[model samples]
Target: MAPPAQSPESDLTLPIRPGDKPPVPLPTRPTMIRGFTLACPVCGTRGLFRRWVNMVERCPTCHLRFERIEGHWLGSLSINTVVSAVTLLALVTVAMVVTHADPPIPLLLGVCSAVAVVLPVLLFPFTRTIWSAVDLLSRPLAPGEVDPRYDPQELAALAAERAERDRAGDGSGSGLSDPGPRTRRSDEPRPPRSSRPHDR
Candidate 1:
């Protein structure tokens, strides 16, 4: 079947080419916080999920692809499992402490079973976002992974850094606002002098 016609804006939202850097640097604290809220870790733009179990393929604002790599969802599953297990453990511990004299075995079992069934589902979206943030931090963006046009701040920074380099005239300049392109060395290797030079 033929695909629907794409608008110019939609065309611009293409995934960054492999090995390309993301438009802006990923902030650790903010990303984690966003993940907890089930928002896009890169842009913090909300509305990623259409339903509790369904997540959009990419960030609506920044166009950052949620699944950055193959088998990325595995990380989310691991996170969900850990969180669910921990929650169950805490609940069991609290129940044991509260009803020390006669721990209701049947009730505890039922509660644990319910939690085992429900908690993972409830945490599904959250785990996905959290894993995205974690993976982003662990595996830095590659080239062409995310478009830079969406990030004005980083673009401005890059422009300023280039201007600084131009002003320095020796390819020596520091990134003013954020981590950016490496400064080129002032002393570049020159071609060897000709051995047969003579017309003096």
Candidate 2:
């Protein structure tokens, strides 16, 4: 028989354990807005970077590690490149349209060069957060990725959600399908007989 279909929220529901960190609830618009504003994508805390090029190791508020995995910043670099290219293309198009037949080649080159250099620098920080948000959205938080102390409000909301799911007859109170009881199969491997003689 085919497995039962699960709701979208049910997919996001993680199994709660005693020492496990709570799952970070990612609301799309709000998370993206926070990223655009150059704040912590997971927690919305500001001033994450001390320098324009240097971001802190982790978020102070939620302790979210910015670089979730190795080479994570590569996504941010790609985002920066794409944004810079788009900005340059738009500016060049506008300049060409305005100048028409009397386009000043030297002036256009100078402006483009400046934009190429500056826009990436200006967008660097924002791109990092944006990419982080995008990554988080694409790949939901794994265990131990964020800080242990989850936000009180978020925890409360999650608890309420679980309660509702339980009341709705989801079977498993954890919002997942219960396998019922375990039954060992005949084909399953059995422990080998002891070679040593039994002690008296």
Candidate 3:
């Protein structure tokens, strides 16, 4: 069957060209934060999750893998540990300052233990998500670096082919030509643009 006609505003899937280097990683704090919010190391328009807690198979905007590998989330556990520890310490400090009363030694120890245990469980998922965001933002963008969810070799090959075509002057067009500002369709309320760091 013939393909459907594409609207000017339709999402464009640009082929990675050979010789074209992977996007340069953003260096500044703002850029890094933007990457995290965007859930894209490159551009930030992509949504990272299909649903709460379930990462999308691939980035809707950049096509990067949401979960780069099986068991990759183990790193997130470590992140959670650190975040929980920090939070517990801050909370305890605040509690001590606010109470100003010396609690029994046993009571203080019990409180600390309970906070440590409960905090990790409460914060694990959040920390894991944040870690994923951090990883997406900070990873280097070498030409052959593949999105972990996809075959790096295949993507590299594809990029090489595109570079070859571009060098040869095959007129398949360059990156997505700006389609102008998007307008809302009649049936749907436009989703609010996210202000998250990765959403740059």
Candidate 4:
């Protein structure tokens, strides 16, 4: 079954498929660019955290759940690592080329070391929020995807949804996929275990 519609308060600007329109207007800026503001990607609420690096459970305005799943920020780490590595490599290459392949080692070491410490710290917010935008672009938010702990009311609702899906006509869903009935050929007994290599 199709997922439920998104909330009108969602502020992220995403591509529109044919014949689909958001209930609310899209943000003026692209979602990734807006993500750099460290706002909630869905609602663009700037107060997404209590302090540096400490994200709130959900958006205060739209209640869109951040940390959609455990380890959702793992990709942020990858982003930071790749960016830092590339930046460091670029710095090293520039120093080598400008200084005739023998740049001041101490200065290079100091600059790279400081960047190693500062870049990740400064980019933490960007990395995480941008990763959210990337994730959202790849997989648009589905109905009832919020984390359970942050929204207890959704528990009952999701339960009902799953139950209804299960109760739909058998072909509509897949779980056990049980064959309701079976017939025996000629009503004959099966072969003995020793002779039934095909009957695991």
Best by lDDT: 2
Residues 105-132, candidate 3: write the lDDT tens digits. Answer: 6877888899888877766545555565
The runs of at least 3 residues in candidate 2 whose Cα sits more than 4 Å from the true structure, single-residue gaps closed, are 1-25, 151-158, 161-200
Instruction: State residue 41's C-alpha deviation in candidate 4, in Å.
Output: 1.1
RMSD of each: 15.1, 21.4, 25.5, 19.9
Colliding residue pairs in candidate 1 = 16-144, 16-145, 17-144, 19-142, 19-143, 20-142, 20-143, 20-144, 21-143
Q: Which tens-of-lDDT digit does each residue in 1-200 have in candidate 2?
A: 99999988879876777866455557799889999999988779999989998999999988888898999999999989998999899988898789885679899899999999999999999999999889888876765566645543456567989999778765545666667998989999987987998799
Candidate 1 vs candidate 4, lDDT winner:
1
Residues 149-170 of candidate 4 have per-residue lDDT tens digits of 3232444457878888777855
Q: Which residue pairs of candidate 4 clash?
A: none
User: In order, how many clashes per candidate?
Assistant: 9, 0, 14, 0
lDDT, residue 24, model 4 = 29
| Model 1: worst 10 consecutive residues (lDDT sum) | 170-179
Please list all clashing residue pairs in model 2, or write none if there are none. none
Q: lDDT for every model?
A: 0.82, 0.84, 0.62, 0.74
The Cα error of candidate 4 at residue 17, in Å, is: 22
**Over the stretch 1-200, how does candidate 1's per-residue lDDT look in tens digits?**
99899888867677767865444456789879998998877778899999999999988888888887789899899989999999999998999889984679999999999999999999999999989989887776654566666454466668999998788875454445556787767797766887996798
Residue 182 of model 4: what lDDT? 82
